[model samples]
Target: MNAIQLKQMTSAKGFIAALDQSGGSTPKALKQYGVNEDAWTTEEEMFQLVHQMRTRVIKAPAFKGDRIIASILFENTMNRKIDDKYTADYLWEEKQVVPILKIDKGLADLENGVQVMKPMPELDDLLKQAQKRHIFGTKMRSVIKEANEEGIKKIVDQQFEIAKRIIAYDLVPIIEPEVDIHAPEKTKCEELLKKYIKEDLKALGKDQKVMFKLTIPNIDNFYADLMGDTHVVRVVALSGGYSQDEACEKLTHNHGMIASFSRALLQDLSSSQSDADFNKMLKDSIEKIYQASIK
Candidate 1:
């Protein structure tokens, strides 16, 4: 890679955005913000509302700073136009936020305490779509509901398999094997997760690499070794269900893992608020999350 390309990768270190969510996440968010339930019934209406909401958040004046290095988008929103430009282009051209897509279909039935990705028959097409839209990377979700060896192994294998394909498409992959916060053995699961991630990364040729967006382990600083791995370009954390304060506190203890939060980053802003109010709230959240990232 050229020096410029290498520098950009290294600079992609903190506050990656995660706007690509599906299923219950949308409805849950609407309820939390006191939006009317009737407005969310149809897919058409839901997508329109979600597009508007995500657009405001992504292009808000508050995001014009350098702290938020990247953003993930849902497929539907990726194609929408804002100010006569595609959403992805607008983010890059205007705000300098890297665009990424969430490609996995939502989760399916729980099996062996692991939530599997629903059958995604169109991931290849999705990658092509993301590329056409100028997306810089892709992310997918797999959850470890329990910390058993069998469950963790299944989660890791499935994620890496898809992650491999993402790499082949010449786009970066944020491999997320999330351990549920409610799991009884969060530490054990994290240890197992580290082991499997290291092994998978080792088998790759020297040139191959991927980023990780992992759950913050129950024990603080547990992921220091993995964060320091040469093969791991960047390590980011998910908020799961934690409140903003809680998420930021735990994030401070985990060295080198910065925030890529979904809910925690959005909890303070509401659709009912004025645009100015929303922006102010968003600015405050970004400052707090960014501070937590560097703390």
Candidate 2:
């Protein structure tokens, strides 16, 4: 692990950028960026377009490391390049942002009120390549739709199991067990999640450490104790389905948690915008997220 990057992640005053929408979520991400399915007939072409958007965002003046400490990238994006430099290298060298990879294949079918990550048979090989490419850490995700204790326990257990393997490679894992924002039992879901997560944290070896990416809890500062755990490096909040304004607003009341937003971060950006307009919009969004994160 890069010591400087670790310090930045632990002590930085900014939010993480979740630019990791992959095969399952790519179409919607592109559509929101003003590109429709009709715009590309081939999968490769589709990825090319999305990469352009990512490149544009990375090269923008407002994407400095000061207000955006790190970026979570899809595996596809990790393998690609920006300005002729590998994506992770460019992020660290030019933008001063740490790069993290999203390694989950996708979510499994909902069972027992939760969806676990699909098997990642290629995880070891992916981790090897990530280390070679300057990646600082990794992120994986699963979802909880209700407050079932059995289901949420399974999710957190699987996450910590995978996290141990990632740590064996000397890479930090951002364990993401996202509670569905629209779940009728949202508060209860978070309660169960916290219980399971705390149990898992206690099981870690003395020197082991990891991070977390979670939904903004129903109660403000609910995850504050988790942030201070010796086993935890940082705790970041996902936007889930919240708009930029709503997500930013909620972040302020949650001390010690920082943003790791996807849709909310890119909501104002469109492929059709001129460079000047795109940069300005991204700058404003970053400023809002940054301020909220510091609060």
Candidate 3:
């Protein structure tokens, strides 16, 4: 583990950038950036286009550790390069932003009103590769659609189980069990999610530490206790389909959690914009999110 990155993760006054969109989400991410489906046919070409988009974002003047303390990268992105350096290396070396890799294959089928992560049979190899590339941590996501205690428990347990393995490799894990913001029982879902997380925290070894990426709660400061727990590094909130404005507003009401936004962060950017226009837009977005995070 990088001691400097660990200290930054725990005490940085900035938000995380969720640039980890994978196979399924890549096309949507491209479309929002003004690249149409016809832009690329082959999966390799598709990834190349998305990689170009990511490169633009990373090289932008506003994308430094001053406001973006870290960034989450998809597996493909981790293996790629930015400015002749590996993506993770460029982030830490040039920008001072910690690089975290997304490790989940994707979500499983909706069962028991939740979607646990698909099996990651190659996690060990990937973790080894991540270590070689200087990745500081990992992020994996599961989803909760309702307040099914059994399902939520499974999600939390699976996350912590994998977290322990990642920790054994000396990498922090950001456990993400996202509660659907539109669920009818959203509050109840968060309540149950918290209960399960608290239980899992107790089971962690004394020296182990982890982070969380969760949906903005229905109640302000709902995860306050978790934020203050000794085992937690930092608690971050995902945009969870919220617009930038809405996500920023909600973030202010929560004292400790910071933002780890993807859609909201990129919504204003497009391939059509000039470099000047693009940089200005990204700078404005970063300023808003940075202020919201430090509140």
**Model 2 lDDT per residue over 10-80, tens place:** 99899999999899899999999999999999999999999989999999999989899999999889999
Give a tens-digit lDDT track for model 3, residues 37-82: 9999899999999999999999999999999999999999999999
Question: Tens digit of lDDT per residue, candidate 1, span 210-245?
Answer: 788888888888778877666676889999899999
Model 2 misplaced stretches (Cα beyond 4 Å): none
| Runs in model 1 lying further than 4 Å from the true structure | 1-6
Q: Give the local distance difference test score of model 3.
A: 0.96
- Cα deviation in Å at residue 235, candidate 1? 0.6
Q: lDDT at 245 for candidate 1?
A: 98
Question: Clashing residue pairs, candidate 2?
Answer: none
Candidate with the greatest lDDT versus the true structure: 3
Q: Please, what is the whole-model Cα lDDT of each candidate in the order they appear? A: 0.81, 0.95, 0.96
**Cα RMSDs, all models:** 1.9, 0.6, 0.6
Alpha carbon lDDT at 60, candidate 3? 96
C-alpha lDDT of residue 108 in model 2: 96
Residue 115, model 2: lDDT of 100
Against the correct fold, how does model 3 do in TM-score? Answer: 0.99
